[model samples]
Target: MGFLDISHVTKSYGQVQVLHEVDIAVQEGEFLVLVGPSGCGKSTLLNMIAGLEAISSGDIAIKGRVINGVHPSKRNIAMVFQSYALYPNMTVGQNMTFGLEMHGVPKPARDAALADVAKLLQIDHLLDRKPGQLSGGQRQRVAMGRALVRNPDVFLFDEPLSNLDAKLRVDMRTEIKKLHQKLKTTIVYVTHDQIEAMTLSTRIAVMNKGYVQQLGTPKEIYDTPANLFVATFMGSPAMNILPATVVMEGGQPHAEITDADGARRLLRFSQGNLAEWADKPILLGIRPEAITDPEGADRKSANIQPLANRVTVTEPAGSDTFVTMTLSGKDVIARMRADAMVAPGEVFDFAINMDKAVAFDPATEARIPQ
Candidate 1:
């Protein structure tokens, strides 16, 4: 059995079904992230795992032991909240040891636990300071230290970095990843930010409308999204999905794309067994980074094909330029080097790496297996 198992879990509120039957399995020391937009039930699922929310049906198990109705504290899980959830009046040290002290652990033992975690989290200097006196990141560390002092079986983070500024959020993300490496414990984190999930998770469960849409490693989820929802939801600027038709040209399957102006271009996919899909409509998805300059094309994989779609707009980010062009009636973005200063209305030689390009069944919005 997996270290943590969520089996056929469901949730509802008086005729309103929120979370559908959901299942996820997380291995020991695995960092699993539940990510989706607001109201998608990612937080609700985390709460269910923590025993804060009652499961309407199905079971949750920790190491094969069913914890259906277990109390939150008895579950031996520590939760760090987005708000930090620190005690206003208590100092960092006091906040860190309160749970231990409440359980009647002797003062000496509690102090020892606090000291070790404080030093480990590098918050020893701020132990005596109150949460109010600490910066957002510091307060977050104290909250984490509070959870760490218990040394629970699993760490649950409910969007812990949501309150921090962008740079601090990135820093805290690194710290959390390092902490996981150092402790090698199981963790289940919930967040609406796909970037956080991609950066922090050993595996990610992408949810939508109360259902787990896709669950896989970051690379798996990004490169081979299960459906249109996952393909459009998990990346920054999302994946560019365009309408296309599969056709056979010279015994090989190719996707024919027609822009708004009726200009046509063909993109060949590396996968086989696509001959039967000829003349059928499909959703063609390509990431911005995959459509890059010819020199930047990945040489290792031979899925690189050439095309020149007329650029309609260009957004110059510091490290890369986002070039926008109409592809098969859809606006698609391509990531190019910042120095490639192609003017709008110009047709630039864009190399497309389709080794990872995906096709979806337009009727079901499900990816077509290669």
Candidate 2:
């Protein structure tokens, strides 16, 4: 039996459906991330699992027991909300122990739990201070510490790191991962940030418009997205999707892309199970890294073709430079080495890693090969 099972769970507020028969199974100690844009029902799903929101239909089970109708406190789950939700007047230590105090836990046990969690979160010295006295990151750690004190069957995080600044968010992301590793607890985390989902999740459920678009490991979701929504949503620079038509050239399939300058290019993919997409309009999906400068040693062994395009915009961020160009009448960004020198309006040649490109049906938006 799965440790946490949300079986065909659905929720609606009046006539507006927020979650459409969402289903997810989390293994024991698995870190599952539910990620999507705001109002996509990721947090609603998390709330349902936390028992904060009532399920419109279907069931939720934890540790092989149904908890659909259980109260929030009785579900043996700890939830850390985005707002921190800390007691304003209480010190950090008191906030961390408030739940245990209400549960009638002895002072010794509460103190021990506070000491252990404070040390684990590196907030031991700040325990005597109130939430107002700490930084955003420190308050987040206190919120997490409050959750950790319970050692509940499941931990629900509703964008717990969203309140922090970028640098602190990254730091807390690492802290959460380390805490998960040390505690070996089942965690269901909700967030709108794709990078957070990619970095922290054992499996990610990409939600959109009250439905789950895809659920898979970070690599799987990035390399082989379920549909157009997922492909466009999960990546940082976003996957470069261009409208193209599939044509059979010399008994093989090829994606023909027409550049903004009216120049035409043919990209050939491996032919095996793509016979059905012949002579049809399709969307070609390619990551920015796949189309890069061909100076690397790995480019020699790869089947890539050089395409020349004039750069419209160049953004350098120390490590890599992002160059944007017009391709197939759409803006496409490519990541190149920062040392590579190319200015705006200057044409540069890049090799497209055609083997990594994916094709999607234009009408249905599903992957073509599968």
**Tens digits of lDDT, candidate 1, 178-292:** 9999899899999999999999999999999999999999999999999999999988887999899998888889999977777778988888677789999999999888888
Q: lDDT by residue for model 2 over 1-370, one digit each (tens)?
A: 5899999999999999989988888999999999999999998899889888899999999989999888889899999989999999999999999999999999999999999989988899999999999889888989999999998999999999988888999989998998899889999999999999999999999999999999999999998899999999988799999998787788778888987778888887764456577777889998887877777314544468678888899999899888898888899998888976768899888778877788898889887764
User: Which candidate number maximizes lDDT?
Assistant: 1
Which regions of candidate 2 fall more than 4 Å away from where they truly are? 297-301
Report RMSD for candidate 1: 1.1
Ten-residue stretch with the least lDDT total in model 2: 296-305
lDDT of 1: 0.91
Candidate 2, residue 182: the lDDT equals 86
